[model samples]
Target: MKPYNRRLRILCLLLPMLCLSLLRPVPELRADPSAGASTDDREILQNSLSVVEIDREIERITAQQETIQQELNKLSGQLEDKLLQIQDQQSRAGAVIRSYYMGEREGLLVAVLSAKDLGSLIHMYDVYDMIMEHDRTVLDAYQSEYKEIKNTKLAMEKKTADLEEMKSNLIEQRARVSALQQKVDQGIASSSDPEALKKMIEEFTLYWENVGLNEVKTYFNALASAMNDLPEFIQNQDGAIRTNGTTYNIDIKEDDLNAFLRSKNDLFKQFAFHFGEDEITASGQSGTLSLEVQGHYSVEEQPQNSIMFHVDKLVFNGYELPDTTCRQMEEEFDLGFYPQQIVSFVKATEVKSTDKNLHVTLKLSM
Candidate 1:
């Protein structure tokens, strides 16, 4: 073959090989199929599990401590009762001793000498013996009760000490778990592989999304427990819902509302919804009786992407709240109303209510 022809043939072969190389699949860094986890993933999972266990331990210890405290309180009451009984018994004994020293003995002696018959003297002697025995029995009962009270106090002290020690150990375990979590978080953050970091984020996001609704429900349940009743819709904000022949409306911010539903205070920072001229703000506060969420959002400026809730009626403490101004409500009634729960990201076309149930319509941005 001619030299030019030979060179052309060689180029054709080289080009196909280069294309094949480019089309070939790149090697992936993956977890072992048999092991079912990558080293980093396993580490993260283990750290998470450790944290959960530590939290459980802390809760158990706290419960135990509370029980111990209750026992201590009961012991205190018992001790007080015992002390009162001892005081009463001591007073009776002192009175008895005083009577004997101040002339009761002389009187008894004179009565015995002046008795008209042996039978009368015998009867007087019997009365004297019975009185002495009654005083001795009271003193003995007081001493027995005092001993029992002393023992209970000692047991209470020991229980308190044990509870303190348990709490200390739980604290140490929590610190350890926290340290491990920090390490795991740092490892994930410092990862140089973009793909790995992305996977981690996706996993976390999926986990949170799955549990988000339930968390919101739990938060509401907690709120109800704290407040002793759910408040009227008007006390909360502007939204409309109808149930059991009643319509309800309130004003609320979308983000704050979702945060309430998700039971997460942090979600409030993610979105801003203006309700008229005012932007909505949300904050969480704990009172002695309940958790309080406060904020306001304008209805006119409801963002296109925000969630909206409408309710027809709200029932609290077996009474349906009237649709009235907040100022008009009874002073003693506290509307434990807050923005919570994100039901959907899609808007609904129709809203309805039933006799036994309050129907709520949720609107979500497409």
Candidate 2:
């Protein structure tokens, strides 16, 4: 008896069906109330699983396109090399021809002048004539070969161009797939946790201008610094460490870890907006949003001065906040917050250390 890998078996069964689904044009829906309900239900189904399917298709298509592009690029490079080689051969042939025919002393004249005796002069003339004839033959052959190579190169270039066009079309298709996937994913994410969605939007507004800042390189560097300070923070009660009064155990798996990273990245986008030296405006089919900081110092604004700040710690909703006397703002607004939910800039303090720069940790509602 063989062990069953259910997911693999389902995927194998659905492979053909999935391909068939892609071939059919999407159907149109009626606009009645019942039709609207059906549409909503269908949307939920798409949000749940269609987005993942679309992502898988996109990955497959993108990989195929990349492979094709690499092959086309290689063929184009080889064709270009062949063209250069042909041109070089032609140039060498031309130089040989010029030497034999266009020099001040022709081959015949040089041979006659160099020969000492009559028989030797006759043999030299014959040899010079034979050499010139051989050179002509070689030049003619090279020209013919060069022409052939040129024609072949043209054909290959046409083929490469066709492949590139095909790749471009495929890339466009992949973009469509990616956009659809994002829409479905967003819908699912929104339905699952509206609070988290709001947090993502708010954070995206913060460091929106710092697309470069969200790089893995910077993330890793920041993470390194944070990790290095962990020991000292854990030692002191006033330090950055937090304790739940009991042993804290997490139940996250690998997939959850990946989701956490994505959520973290989204959170990073929120921080990026806070550092906004300049306003960033992005408009998509779904919506338009803008992020800007009101200050004299604009980082991307190319201002003369730009303020730098570091986040010390994050405060989520309902946590024991430093300002115990302060009222919770979200409660007044009737907005509920949750764990891992990012909030707005509450009261912050400037680092009293040497630099005297400001550092803020956003306060969130749980």
Candidate 3:
């Protein structure tokens, strides 16, 4: 063979292998069905787990605080009832005293004098002593109940103070956890390489084939068509032909378009393709297209055919797209593709720019 022909054949044989090497799973990407992860990747995962634990702790503390507040409210009501009981007792005592004073000042003496004999006078004196003794017993009971209520109120107030202190401490702890979480997040973000992140995002799309839902399968077919068609439309550069004879231009940078599609592979694995970020610009006669999507696949409890995907950040050309606009586009994409049984879900949360690249963090279900 000619030297030039031999060289060409060797190049052809090696090209596919080179491509395969580029597409093969990296150590960080081997999270599913295997236990191979680098130290940094494991640390990243640990940080994520720690964040979840912290969140759970915060929730538990909050629930406890709510219970304490309810107890305090119940105690307050009891104290009020006790106060009302004391007032009622005082009123009854005052009424009895007033009735006694209102009676004839010499009533007892008169009764004794009018008695038929000494035996009658002694009996009347005994009756008067019994009435005074009954009154004294009622007064003592009222005073004892008042003291008990006061003591109970003091105890309750002390408990409430203690609970308030506990709640304050919990809040401080929550704040500290939140700060740690932020630091971990920043570390992860800073350490991540955009190219690797993009590759991971692309790898995620392969999981769509694992979806068990027939409806989802159909929706994905349509979604794939729509996604693939966008690039074609841009590549054709022949304005989109309208029935009205007007052509709409769609100018898209090919490299950027490929980068955009590659960055969404991981997102597809997570069922969050709708929110994938467009690292390229596909500007046409219509409007610009840019997006950022984040999502995940789970066999756990989740709504069927429902993806919790959010476009947390988006931009079109130099202009930032409003959340509403981003959402509208997402809805339009769904409606335009699978109108019968909607499979994809999207929610736009915010618009922000970051180094003109799509950065995604992989989240694998364990």
TM-scores, each model vs. reference: 0.39, 0.28, 0.36
- Of models 1 and 3, which has the larger TM-score? 1
Which stretches in model 2 have alpha-carbon errors above 4 Å?
Answer: 1-40, 43-57, 76-88, 99-133, 148-167, 182-366
Write the residue-wise lDDT of candidate 2 on 47-150 in tens digits.
32333333444565567667766776776777677777767677778778777567733747776778999999889887777877877887887887777777
lDDT of 3 by residue, 1-366 (tens): 699999999999999999999998654322231125455644444444345445655676677778878887887888888888889788877766775788832586578678998899899978777877777877886888789798878878887887888688677767767776776566557665745533432343222113211223333344455564453443443432212122221223334544444454432332222212332222211111122322221111223322222333343212243333334344444422110121112211222223333222112212
Q: Lowest-scoring 10 consecutive residues by lDDT in candidate 1?
A: 317-326
Model 1 segments more than 4 A misplaced: 1-35, 96-118, 192-366
Q: lDDT tens digits, residues 1-366, model 1? A: 699999999999999999999999764323222134456765564454445445555676678778888887887888788778778777776787787779876787777778798999899888767876886787677678778878977987887788789778767866776796787678677667646654654454333334322333344444334333223322354443332222232233344444444443343333222232222222332221111222231122233432222222322211222222111221223323222323223333332222222233334434
* Cα RMSD (angstroms) for every candidate in the order listed: 23.7, 25.4, 25.9
Residue-level error in angstroms, candidate 1, position 357: 66
* TM-score for predicted model 1 compared with the true structure: 0.39
Pick the winner on lDDT between candidates 1 and 3: 1
Candidate number with the higher TM-score (1 or 2): 1
